[model samples]
Each structure stands twice: as structure tokens, then as C-alpha cells.
Target: MRSSVILLLVGISLAFAGKHSLKYFYTSVSGDKTFTATGLVDDVQFMYFGINTKKASPKTEWVREIEESDYWKRQTHLLVEQHHWILNTIWTESAGEHTYQITYGCEWNDETGKTNAFRQYGYDGEDFLFLDLKRDEWISPVKQGFRTQERCNNETIRLVHWKNYLKMDCIETLKKLLTLGKSSLEKTVSPQVSLLQKNACSPVLCHVTHFYPSDITVTWMRNGQELKNVKVGKLLPNEDGTFQKTVTLQTEADEWRKNEFSCVVKHQSKTFRKTLTEKEIRTKNKTAAPFDVTVVVVLVAVILSLSLIIGVIGYFVYQRKLKPALSGSASKCWLSFCRISGYVTANTSPSDSENTSQSSTES
Candidate 1:
């Protein structure tokens, strides 16, 4: 489910610049009326809304200072309409309660004027209908979506509205949110870049983890020339909503010894370049930590894990609200991130006034 979300949305952007996206994810379960709407600035989920709660909630501290209650009210109203639309559309088509998801957003390059946007609809874990902004067409892969395609084809105005929304309004909203939360948005955690190999002959994996703002680039360069045959892994979510990614070089270990092969990573303003070398590889045979150091690390990890668990549980108790319980496998949730808090700071609106944003939303 999360991998699907990752395909639909971005890992996330802003103060550090480059590019940014404003996207929304909505899900309606078969028997659940309290569906949630997630609003993300690039990859970071900053706001959430629920049909039951009827409140647009902030997910980050910086967003709490938006000072626009009406903006949130408009967002709540828009999401509410969107929430019902997805549910009713699914129910009408399936002739029964069915779960469905909507992922819609726009991407913008801050340095350049490049912009792109999309709307993808999914039901029962498959693509149902999607808007091809470039082609200005609605694509429905499954037979179940024929009516939807036909309806969308006939509604040229809605298509135009969406085009404008994605191109203009969504981009503007993203920019505003970036400005609103620059201090928090710019906070980044440098990736822990490590070259790991299980054995001398195994695939040499450049593992990057615990990085923030998810816009890191990993390139395999041999003697400063880019290597195209490398296997690049997906950007995966972390336990704390950070990200991890892997780039694999599937060659004999001797290749790096003969050439200066480097794994270069660029994120925000920092760049990490790690050359492949035997001494740098954390091989099982030789790279194991000293016994005492290993024990100390394990003990500290255990203590920290226990402390984090207690702190999380305490947060739930004191807040008196729970959206979704945290699990040990949070890092494994690729895209549909686990909701660990009911308390969030709310922040995006349409390009124009509240009515303008809301008007485009109802479509």
C-alpha cells in the first residue's frame, strides 16, 4: 500500500531549494467513514483531515502559525467534498462499499519555471482513472472505469480547472507552505552513507539512511564517469518519517580496486561522495566492531528504543487522541506513512481566494 503511495506522491522540498510539490492523498476504506486526507509538501506530510473529525489538522509545529483559520476551514470543506466523492464514486461503481484512493498533486521547479501536475485514481489496488495533463486526456485502464472516463471526457470545464489548479494554484500553495514553514522545512539530517557488502563477491550496496527532505541524488561514478548499469533502489520511508535509499553496483569487487569508483550523494546543500574500497566496506568477515564496542552499541540502542517506545506511548496518553497506533515496522511502510500523532500543525490552499481553491476542489 505504501509503495503504491510512493509511486503516486513524492518523498518530498523548500528553503534549501531545487524543486517542490504539493500533493494530497485521500483514502476511503470499505466500512470506515472516518477516512483521512493527507496533505504533503513534497514528501513531508504536514496536514491531515478526517471525515469524522471534520477538522483540518496540522502535522508539524511550523504549520501551526499559519494564522489563517479561514484557509483551514476552506481546506476542511474541500477535503470533505473530496472524501465523499471518492467514497460515493467507488460505491456507485462497485455497487457495494469499496476502498479507493486518490492521489493528486503538482510539481514545481523553484529555480526553473518547470511545472507538472496529475490526478490518479485507484480502486482495489489498481489504476482506475488518471488525468494526463500533458495530453489533456483521462485514461482508464480497467473496464470498470469506462463510465468515469466518459464522464470526465464530457466535463471539459473540470479538466481545465484541474489543469489550472495543478499548474498554478498547487504550485502557489506549495511556495506559500514553503515560506510558512521554511525554518522547519529547511531542517535536514545528513545521510549516513555506508558501503556494505555481505561478502567479497556480493552486490556492493551503497546504503543511505536517516536523511531528511528525501531529495537526495545518488550516482555511481567510475573514475568520475557516470555508470549506467547500477541498480538504484527506491526511496523508502524511515521510522521517523526520514528516508533511506540504496544504490547497488553489481560487479566484481576488483572493479573498484582498479578504478576510483565513487558513490556521490547530493541533498540540500551537502554532498557526500564515498569511494569504493576494501577498507571502506563493512564486510561481515572483517568490519565487525570490537566485542566491547558492539555490546555498548547494542545496549545503547536497546535503551533508546525503550525510551522512544515509552515516550510515544506517553504522548498518546497525554494527548488523549490516537489516529493510528505506531508499529515496529514503521520504516517498512513505504509511502502511506503511519500516523503517530493526532496533534499536527495545519498548512495549503488554492491559488486565489478560499473560494477559488474550494471551487477547483469540488470538481
Candidate 2:
């Protein structure tokens, strides 16, 4: 039961593992030369070569010819025959989008006779698979894949020698290509900086746009001192393959007018600064006056309306209490008046009869 539960959990975990397209790139760097070969796994389960910029033939022509070559066919057959089970299992079990990259490269040191070579596998940008140079064993993060590869000891041994041979043979071609690419590349471009204000009281934004290499620094300063309340946005890629960034400095209208706030951008060994002046703030405030007036008016109207509603409710509640008290008091007063009148009439009538009898006796 325990074993079954463990296996079930492992299966469920692996079910959500991401599927990835496989891409292999080979680079040889020797002296000033560089050579590269890139292959992508296609939908038909075969490796398709993309570009060999070193070749004289057109890229499409080379891809077409390579597909029909005996080497390509044999390699494809060997890969499918040896690893079809693992590939099929991964394809069936995994889910979502990801790409697996395999980079094989050899760098030949001019002073040293031997080459430094590596074969590494990564998912997205993180490396998780490697080949042991001495043991020729496959190191993988996937438990199942590692276990399966471990069983193929003889094949692993053969692959080690083959990879070593490839590293040695490709180093010369790579060095030449590196030199060619370096010679043709252009110098990096500097970033352009601009100041943007959304409104008078809002944060002042310093936009740095169209920079090459993507490494840049943007900072905000207030009164010649670096400000800490600076918000830097993410580095965004532009449509033209350059990068852009924005840094914002928050300040009140009075503070902005009182102190000199500046946006400083450093890119490609050049520094650019744009300052926020009192004039700009005044202009923005002037433009926003109508909007500010409208907002104030709306707020005052809402407050007045609420006050009127509250006054009406208070008056009604006062009237309700006053009416009940007045009714009770009126009933009490009427009762008191009737009692007093009855007492007075009884006393006065008795007194008058006594006075009349006394007057008749005197007569």
C-alpha cells in the first residue's frame, strides 16, 4: 500500500511537468574564429538543421540538402531507435510550454594543446542535465530519465568517446567563425532620455528609450542629492530589439517647485540628465486648473447633498420625539385641570350656602 501510494504521488507530480521542444547548438571557438551549428527537433520527430552561417550555400538549400544526407538519416535513425521510449513517455506525460536547450562547445586555448569542452542541457535558462566527463554517465534532474539512462552503460561509454572526438574536431572551424562575426558587429548605441509629466501633482517620469545591450542605470535626484523614493520600472523590450526603462520620482507640487529634481540616465558609458523646473510645474498646474476646479466642485456638491439629507433626517426625528412628548403632556394637563375644577366648585358652593344661612338668621 505504501509503495503504491508513493508511486501514485510521483505519477501525479510528473503529470504536470512541462513538455519542451529540444534544441541543440554546437559552437567551436578557436583563436579569432567561431563556428556554430544549430538543430531543432521538428514535429516529425527528426532533427532539422537550421543555419550554418559558415557555409557558402544558402540557408534553405543547406537545410534541404542536409535532410537528405546519409549522415542525417543515420543519426536520426540511431536517436529514435535508442531513445524513442523515453521521448514518447516524456511527450505523453508532460504538459505546458518550455524549451530544452543542449549546448555543446569546445574552446581551444592557443597556449595549450588540448581543448576545454562541455555538453550541457538546460530547461529554459536553468541547467539541470549534464554529462560526466570521466565516467561518461548521464546526469539528469528527472528521476525516471536518470534511472533509465543508467541502465545503458555500454551506450553511455561509447557516447563519451564520440563527444570528445567531436569537441576536438570542431574547434578549428569555430575560431574562424568567431572572428568573422566580431568583425561585422556594430558598436552599441546610447540611450535617449526624456522627461514626462502626467499632471502637476503626479510623479515625474524619466523615460530612457532605445538602448543597446540592455545594461543601464537610471536614478532620481532632488536638490543635487540622490532621492530614495524613486520607483524604477521593469526593463521593457522595444519593437526594434532595443530596450527601454522608466524611473519615477514622486514629489508634491510645492516641493517640486522649491527643489530641483532631476532624472539621470547612464547608458553605454554616457550619462544624461533631465531636470524638472518650476516653469514646467506652473504650466502643468495651469493646464490642470479646470480639472482641479471640477473635482473640487463635485466634492463640495456631494458634501452639501449629504448635509441636507442629514439635516432633513434630524428634523424628522426631532419632530417624531416632540409629537409624542406633547401628546403625553396635553393628556396630563387635561386630567389636572378637571380635578382642580371639581375641587374648587365643591368648596365654593358649600361656602356660599353657609353665607346665605348666616345672612337669613341675622335678618
Candidate 3:
């Protein structure tokens, strides 16, 4: 009777064990680039994953980052042979436009409910076959870590994981985020060159204006070298929603000959760009030169003329004193010296003949 009881107990245990059904669900995606799903099962564990890209060769099988609890949990239950777990599944989109495909597949041990965690699976020339399910089916958006019915939508399904049950709606959210990033990529500041001055001035000043949404940085580069001693000015925003910065560079009179300056605009992840120098800064300088020259010439002439007049008056007073010191013969000598020296050159011209003096004697 004890033997019969043992047989009956074993049969019952086997039947109950066979009845236990373990269902593992996940999603796979494909398109531009291919990646597999992470966090395959909460109580269950990640087994393995396969990565394949069109442009590149397929990657060797690798395991995802699994938690200690997941590892320990799988250990508690004895593992069986050839158990495949859902691995990395992600969607890749094409360039220029938005399109993606998801690829994922898994094989679980039917005999043992627990998975074989130690072994790695390699791609044997056959691509993974995944059941593409509706993305909305698996998307249960959780607020505060709890899934809700309101967040679920039916149309959110992705075609990549139609075979298996992995929530694919998250791909839509990822795609949306990527699209947003791409749209703003063009909006980033691109270096532009423009001429601010049509005519050159003494110190040619170049104004660089950047049309960007955020605060901008401006640097002056002269022939690919960073400029120093440049009179840098403030950056101000225009009424029409753009930024304007002014930099004044005093080119040595020689610099105007080459006549070039560059304003480089720098922003995040942006590169070399320049604004052409203005013709006005150089042209304006030309107009200023004639005016400056004329002023200097007039100032010098006035100074020289004033000095000549003063010298003539001083000489006349000195001679009057000399006449008293030498009254008689010396007076005649002094007069002869003055005439020979041409002291009266202003009153007489070389082309005119001189008139002789009449002698009057006091007897």
C-alpha cells in the first residue's frame, strides 16, 4: 500500500508541474539602426540578446544589465536546457526622414519553467522572428510607478514586435523626442560673414550680428589668428530679435592696405565661420585724410607768418638805440651797413632803380 501511495504522489506532482505555464512577453524593433529591448522581465531574468545592423556586421551575443535580485531569483529556480530569453530590442530610424523597424525574438524552455541563465546564444545565419504586436497594447504609462488605463491607447502599436508582447509605444515617444532634436539642429548658430562698413575709417570697426535664440559669443580672428588689443564692445539685441556685437580694430595704417578682418561666431558644437570686412571703414578713412592734411598746412602757415612780423619790429627798435651811441661818423656807418645788408628789401624791389638823396648843410 505504501508503494502504491508513492506512485500516485509522483504522478500528481508531474501533472501539476506540467500544467504550470510560463509566458514571457517582449517587443522588438527595426529600421535605421537595430537594438533590442532591456528589462525583459521583472521577476524573470534576461537570458541573451542579438544585435544586427545593415551598414555593419551583426554583433556577437551579449547580456543586458541585470539586477542582482533578477540574477538571484533565477538561481533559486533550477535552470533547464536551451532556454532563450528576450534580449535587446530597439528601433532605428532612417536618415533625413522618420521611419524605423523593430526586430526581436525569444525561445523559452517548455520542460522547465525557469530559464537557463549562464549560456550565451549566437546568431546562426537566421534572423530573429518576432511577433509584431500593437504598440498600444503594451504601453501602460505609469504615474508614480503604477500603470494606468488612461495612458493606454490602441493605435500606438509598432510593427516591429507584432509577434511578441513587448510594449512598443515607447518607440513612438523616443521617435518624437528624436524628431524634436533634429528640428532644432538647423536652428543652431551657423557662422556667417557680412560687411558692416562700406567706407573705411581711421580705426575700422566691424559689427557682427548673430541670429540665434540664445545668448551668443563673438570672437575676432585676423587671418586665422585671434586678435588682441582690439576695442571690443558690448553685445546688444536688436528689436527684431537678433544679437549684434561690435568690435573696433585699429589697423596700423598698413593693415588697411590688405583691408580684411573676420568676426568669428561660436556656439555649441559649431565651427569656423567669418564675416567679411566692411569697405566703409577703409573708404571712410580716405575721406578723413584730405581734411586732416588741410588743417595741418593752415596751422603751420599762420605760425610762420606771425614770427616774421615780430622779428621785423624788434630790429627797428634796436637800431634806434645804436644811433644815440654813435652820433657823428658812426651814424653814417650804421646807415651804410643797414643799406648794404638789404634791411629795407621789403620797401624796395631789385627791379626798380634807386633815387639819390639831396644834401642839405646847416652852416
The lowest-lDDT stretch of 10 consecutive residues in candidate 2 is 13-22
What is the C-alpha local distance difference test score of candidate 2? 0.54
Best by TM-score: 1
lDDT of each: 0.77, 0.54, 0.38
| lDDT, candidate 3, 1-363, per-residue tens | 234333333322221221111123222332333233322221122333324311111111222212133542442231211112212221221124222222332322224643211111122222222222423233322332122223322334432334222232232222222222222312434434343443333555555665543335666677778788878788565554445676676665446447545666654436445544333233433423212456779999999999988988889988887767775688678668756554443456544313321111111
Worst 10 residues of 1 by lDDT: 337-346
Best by lDDT: 1
Model 3 segments more than 4 A misplaced: 1-201, 258-260, 267-363
Q: What is the Cα root-mean-square deviation between model 2 and the actual structure?
A: 23.1
Give per-model TM-scores: 0.68, 0.38, 0.25
TM-score for model 3?
0.25
- Steric overlap count per candidate: 10, 11, 42
**Residue 85, model 2, lDDT:** 40
